[model samples]
Target chain A: MHLLSIRDLVVKFRTHDGTVHAVNGVSFDLDEGETLGLVGESGCGKSVTNLAVMRLLPKPAGHIEGGEVVFQGQDLLRLDESEMRDLRGKEIAMIFQDPMTSLNPVLTIEEQMVETIRAHRRVSKSQARARSLELLTMVGIPKPETRLRNYPHQFSGGMRQRVMIAIALALEPKLLIADEPTTALDVTIQAQVLDLLQRLAADLGTAVILITHDLGVVAGMTSRLNVMYAGFVVESASTPDLFARPRHPYTVGLLHSMPRLDAQPGEPLIPIEGVPPDLRRAPVGCPFAPRCAWRLESCWTGMPSLEPIDQTAQIVTTGPNVTHRVACWNPATPDEAVAARPLREGFTPAAAPAEAVA
Target chain B: MSGVTGQPAPGAAVGVASTGTEPGRPLLEITDLRMYFPISSGILISRHVGDVRAVDGVTLAIQKGETVGLVGESGCGKSTVGRTILRLYRPTSGRIVIDGQDITWAEGSTLRAMRRRMQMIFQDPYASLNPRMTAAGIVSEPLEIHGVGSSSERRERVRDLLATVGLDPDYGDRYPHEFSGGQRQRIGVARALALHPDLIVADEPISALDVSIQAQIINLMERLQGEFGLTYLFIAHDLSVVRHISDRIAVMYLGRLVETATSRELYDRPIHPYTVALLSAVPIPDPAIERKRRRIILTGDVPSPSDPPPGCHFHTRCWLRARLGNPERCVVEAPALRELASGHAVACHFAEEVDGSPEQVLQVTGEGMGGSSSRRADDSPTGRVAAAGPGLAT
Candidate 1:
């Protein structure tokens, strides 16, 4: 059974200029103890989707306009403020992008962690402090006893992020939402943090919603992947399946655009042509139509709903279960019929060489 | 200037060589460059004592139309070196020669003219671009300041430049806030290109953008360099991105260059312990390889730049130093940046031989020998003479 299910979710921001449709009819599910990677560029609403689920969107600016966020058979949207608050830290916790900003600067690490622990639990002060130290040590912060007295500013960026993770995991929430957790960190620190998250989630059996713009990180850490474009999940599939046979033009473009370490030196990096669509005005058709290299005329007139491509039938029917989906009318396949069809009128398939297979 | 093809012809416009005394010289040469900001105490009366020696004695040579990548963790002074070359921050002392001109001491109009030839592309696209101004206005400001042309001519130039950088000319009137991160970065690139600069210092130009967008900017930069014969000092902390674009890569540690070599050389056979650890840490996209790779987890946080370690700046956390029995000499004296092989320079006391193998050469020279017992015992007069090659001391 799905651990968390989001169906036809729509989110809007009430900006001064107008109402912005940040997320439009987006639907996906996270299985129990599974890692779902949400990949998208800025303004693509990957973060907004996570925020809506966490009910952490700012008032008067953001609100869930439509859809069901069913977490373990409970409708989060139906929950009152107090009811949602109880569920937030106890059941579903979130780790924001920047750890420094997320942490309380004035409070000691111990004080902050203890406060979090005591906030949701009926525990004595000493018990809370003891638990805080345990959490600190669990996250791999060195000299936990002495370090607990130090303030947030005393820790490094990586350590501070770990502290945030420690606090988030204090309750061992069923679902952990991490929004670009390692974007600001160095590579080494990023590797450590990612490894820590993966290990912790496995040990705790916690499902993770990892939102990021990095495809490499997603490929490394995630079991399931959702590629978002213009506030909608353009494609969704198992990590390996998506990478192996991406059907959507946007997904293909993203894969091509990445500067792979394995790529030949001086090989031209294929960049998507244009920017993401403006959210203030809802897109008439496909949001990525402007930049799609293999865009069809129909793409500009009407948006395509998520549909399983025919080529994925083999994997989709497998025992482990593969639910590969793409929101594109003209899905590419490695067969003669699809390959023979022109990407664009008067556009030859041979014109754009498939440089790297992988 | 129409259809100029932007590529500087081989040996074209040799107006003035930076090192005129030495024939066939590099276009820009920075030798023993240092920029130190003192940490002072008291408000009423500040006292000078300690210093954050950012960009401490860096030496590099950029040939015409070549892109050199300066990369390191944040606070390693890669950005400082780029800014210092542009005189954004005046170097404490060093020689900066550009086309035979000693720009290190150039002032007033001379410096302003020099500035026209050397421009910078800032990292933060949102912060760098003026929100109030139109994209056209931002791109044309440099042209107007330099008195490149009349109003109409500048407008045409701006349009052409916009087209050159893959932006729509009609969108020139649009504010920076209206553009996406990648588009705004294109505008930044167009502004940098406004002066027709020979050298561009791109300081983490694409770091703010998304991964997909990063490739767009990098590819655009590569294309622009080919079309315009531009020399780039690409400053970035992302090793992978740097490797993708750089002809040569320089690794900085605590404001000093610890390793410098060709991108291929650095990636395949990194000599510096820091470089090795850094390379090892980069997550390979392949899950199979990623799972198999062992990450060299460096212990402890980067030491405060204000109170950098005494001997070797990286000695406190040097993985190789610890493996090499933590020699007392490493704590007493700093290692010289010496060229171990062709185009590969490393700064390490024991950088000579890898794992104590006889095939690896370990030789100390000059003042380096006088300070260390290990070096004195290991060094011969013949070895000292051989190691004292060109640009060895600096």
Candidate 2:
């Protein structure tokens, strides 16, 4: 059974001019103990999708227009505020992108952790403090006892991120939503943080939904991946299957554009042209049509439903279940002969019209 | 001038002859550059002194039309070196020669003119670009300050600059807040190009943007460089980004240059222990290689700059030092940056003798610095020293 499932989720923000459809008809599922990565560019609605699941979207300005967020056989969207609050810290916890903003500046680390523990459970102050120290040590922070008294400002960026992780793990929540947790960290620190997250998730049997703009990070850490375009999930598949055979043009572009550490210097990086479409006005068809290299005419006129490329064939023949699914009308065939064709390159901007896909 | 004769002060021109061949002269020469800010106590701040040596004794030369990358972790002072070159902050000591002109002491109009030839692209586009100013006004402000052209010409040039950076010319009338992060950064690039600068200092320009947008900006910069014959001083914490754009790469740590070499040389075979550790830490995309790849996890936080280590800035955490037996000299004397190969330079006491292979370095430091004490005896000089390796001072 799926641990969390999102179906046709639509989130919108009411602005001065009009409502902005930040997350439009996005859908995905995470199995028990599975790591799912949500990849997209800025303003692509990846963060909004996760926020919708957490029911943390700002009210008055933002609301979920339509969706069903099913978690452990219960619909989270149907839950009342008080019921959701009870489950929030104990069953589901989220680690935001910026640790500095997420943490309270005035409170000591011990005070913050104890409050979180006390809010969710009836525990003594000393017991709560001891549990907090254990969480801190589990996340790899040095000298947990000494660090408990320190304020957020005293810790370095990396340590602060580790503290955020510790707070997220306080209740041993079944699921964790980490939104670009290591984006601001240095590479070395980033590696350590990722390693810690992977190990803890496996040991504790906690599911994680990792939201990021970096394809390399997604490729490295995620078990399953979702490629998001303007407010929609363009592709979804297992990590190895996605990397081995990407179907959506947007996913292909993303994979090709990243400059990996293993790649030799001076090789030309293939960046997708143009920017993500404005979310204020939902597009009639594929949002990535303007930037996709292999976009067809149908992509601009009508939206494509998420469907299996071939119903008869399984996504991964070796896996226990077929999980790969893409929302592209003309998905690329995963064959060595077809993949061997040279990618189209060097098309001048002047020769091509701005809005035209081909 | 009191203590030194041949060496020049900060921003003064070094008198070293440029080999006289002059095919491509060094556009900027920085020698023994230092920028120190004092940490004080009490209300009146009346103490003897303690200083944070942000940029201490960094020597480098950027040739005309050559892109050089200054790479390091945060707090390493790469940004300070860039700011010092542009004279945004007054340096405490050392020399900065720009276009063969000594602008170290130049003030008022002279300094303003020097600023025209060198411009900076800041890291945070949202914070850097003034929200109050329109795109056109932001780009043309430099021209207006320098009095380079008339109002009409400046407007026309701003349009051209916008086009050059792959932004719509019509968007110039809009405010910075009206655009996305990538568009605002394009405007930042357009503003940087307004002066037709000889050299540009890009300080983590794409680190704030999305990865896909980062690729676009990097590609745009490369295209602009080829078209305008401009040189770039790219400063970033990511080695992959630096390797993609730089001809030569320099690694800095706690305000000092630890290694310098060609992009391929440094990435393929990093000589400095710190550089090796840093490279091993970056997560590669390929799952097979990533699993097999050796990772170096250095222990302990970076020491405060106000009280850096006594000798080498990196000695406290140097993987090579621990592997080759922690020499006493590493704690007493600092090693000078010397040429190991034709163009590669590394500043480590056992640069040549150390087994700098990624696997060896990772094996030594992977468990963190706690294992250093045990390996100290096995790697000591008395144990076994290679005969033909680089000579050790201790």
Candidate 3:
């Protein structure tokens, strides 16, 4: 059995404007020791999906309308608040993007970490403090003894993020949901944090759900990857299969849009040209049809379900149970994805429909 | 001048006429620019304890019509350098010369007039734009501040500017809150271009943007540069994006420049150890190359600029220093920015040793550049791919 199974998760947020469908029928599976990446632009429902899984969606406003988050045979959505609270930091932990905002300014590193440990495990203050110190040391905090006494404001951006990791792993959770964990850090510091996360997760045999918009980060850090669009998983595959052969037009556009370090210079980047879609009203068509380069007439009628693109892709996969899948009316061929242009002779780019833009 | 880098090459007259710069002079010349913030103790009778040397002893030259990228991690003063160049923060010492005029000490009308030729595009599009102001008002504010044209004329120009920056002219009436992040940034770009500035100091303009929207802004900037003969000081932390847009790239470490070269030259043949490590650290979006690469992950957080390590500011976290038997000279004498072959400049004591070392971290060879051949490192610490593409090559 899979470690975690999220089936058709549909999360909605009641805004002043309208009910925004934050996540629409997003489903995926996580193995015991897998690292899955969920990548997309802002408002693409990657974070909301994970938030729904953790049962940590904002109070009242955000609601999981329909979903079955089956974790180790128990439906996490059906769990009561008290049970959910017990599982939060122990079975599942989260690391937010900005450490400054996530951590309490008034509390010392010791107080916060010890409190988390004590809340989960029935340990005394000193024992919890010792575990906190050990975790800080494991995450490579210099002089954990003295650093633990320091307030959140005293640590540097990188050090503060390290402290956050230390706190999150204090209970040795089976699953970790890191939302843009290193986005606020610099390249070197990001490298350090990602390396630490990867190494520690491997050592602990922990499954990680790394939510970030950076393609480079997902490419290196994640074994399985999901490309998200406006409230939908547009594509899902193993890291190698996803990069080597992206079938979805949105995925292709993303691959071509980014300026790669190894890309040939002066090669013009083909950016997806349009404003991001509004989630206030759910569209009848594919969310990415407006920006897609390869779209068919059928794309405007209905949203395609996440289905397999290549059956043979799972044979040489890096991670377990990762099949190459995409949700699109007209998927791009490997040649089209690589060249980022039409394979046929008389091909024209897909224009945004008039109503879509307005 | 304590550490002036260079003079412009003789007989370079391409962009002089457009910008009114004298022949053989770069568009922007910075000499030993130092910006230090005072640290205080007591609230009422605060004693100046020390200085947070944000940008200390930096020199650079950007030719007319050139996009010079100043790249470094946070707290390395890349943004401070950009702000100091635009005179946002008055430098504690050194000179800033623009269009052959020394504006380091210029005040009142002179500073205002100098500001006309130079402008800045800030990092955060959301925070940068005034929420209360409409897009038209925000873009037209620069023109209005300079008293450039009549009310009607300014209105017309604002509409034109919006269209020029790829925004619909009709969207001018909407406030910043109404527009998306990408559209908001377009308004910011339009505002910067209102004064017809010769140099635009873009301080992490695209960093706040999404990966897809970033290309639109970069392409627009490139097109504008070509059309208006504009020079740019592109300050950013993303090495890949900086390389994509910049002609010359400068690497900063703890307020001082460690390496500067043409983007092609710097990536292919990095001399400074810090540059190599930085190149290695940036995770590229290619799984094939990522699987084979060996990241030289620097061990520690960057030291605080207020109390930067003596001698070499980077010696505290430098991977090369430890690999080189912990040289005493690195911790005793600060290296000056010395010119190497052609346009390349490096500030390092053991640069020759670095030049001779394996391109363990840097293997991103530019196509058609025959000088440096990229080959797989058989001795990479990480597992290696036999023949992956030469990208994400840490």
Q: Please, what is the TM-score per model?
A: 0.88, 0.89, 0.92
Instruction: List candidate 1 stretches off by more than 4 Å.
Output: A311-320, A334-358, B1-23, B352-394
**What is the DockQ (computed on Cα atoms) for candidate 2?**
0.43
In the order shown, what is each candidate's alpha-carbon RMSD?
Answer: 8.3, 7.0, 6.4
Which stretches in model 3 have alpha-carbon errors above 4 Å? A311-318, A349-358, B1-18, B356-394
After superposition, the stretches of candidate 2 with alpha carbons farther than 4 Å from their true spots are A314-321, A333-358, B1-24, B45-48, B353-355, B365-394
Residue-wise lDDT of candidate 1 within A1-358, one digit each (tens)? 5789899999999999898989999988777788889998888999999889989898979989999999999989999999999998889999988998999999999889888888899999999999988998898898999999999998999999999999999998999999999998887678678878888998999999999888778777887888998889888888877777778877777777766654566766777666777799877777776666566667766789987776546534111255788898676654312232234447532221232111
Query: Which residue pairs of candidate 1 clash?
Result: B6-B227, B17-B100, B18-B99, B18-B100
lDDT of 1 by residue, B1-394 (tens): 2222232222243312321334467778999999999888989999997889888889999988889999999889899999899988878999898877889988888999889789999999999999999999999898778776668778887888898898989999999998989999999999998877888999999989876688789988998888778889999988878888999999999988999999866765567777766765666554444433444556566787788888888888766676567888878887889998899999888775432211122221121211111111123221223344332222
Tens-place lDDT digits, model 3, residues A1-358: 7789889999999988999989999888888889999999999999999999888899889999998999888999999999999999899999999999999999999999989998888899999988988999999888999999999999988888999888888888999999999999988788888888888898899899999999999988888999999999999888888999999988898898889776666878888898677899876788777677677666776899887886455432225456788998788988998888669777665665676657
Give the DockQ (2 decimals) of all models: 0.29, 0.43, 0.56
Model 1 vs. true fold: TM: 0.88
Worst 10 residues of 3 chain B by lDDT: B1-10
The Cα error of candidate 3 at residue A130, in Å, is 2.6
lDDT of 2 by residue, B1-394 (tens): 1222222211122312211225666989999999998877777757847889999899999997799999999999999999999999889999998988887667888898779789999999999988899999998898788775667777777888888888889989999999988889999998988776778999999998877778899998898888766789999998888988999999999999999999877776677878877876776655545544555666566788888998888888776677667898889988899998878899987787654453354467554653221112222111122222432222
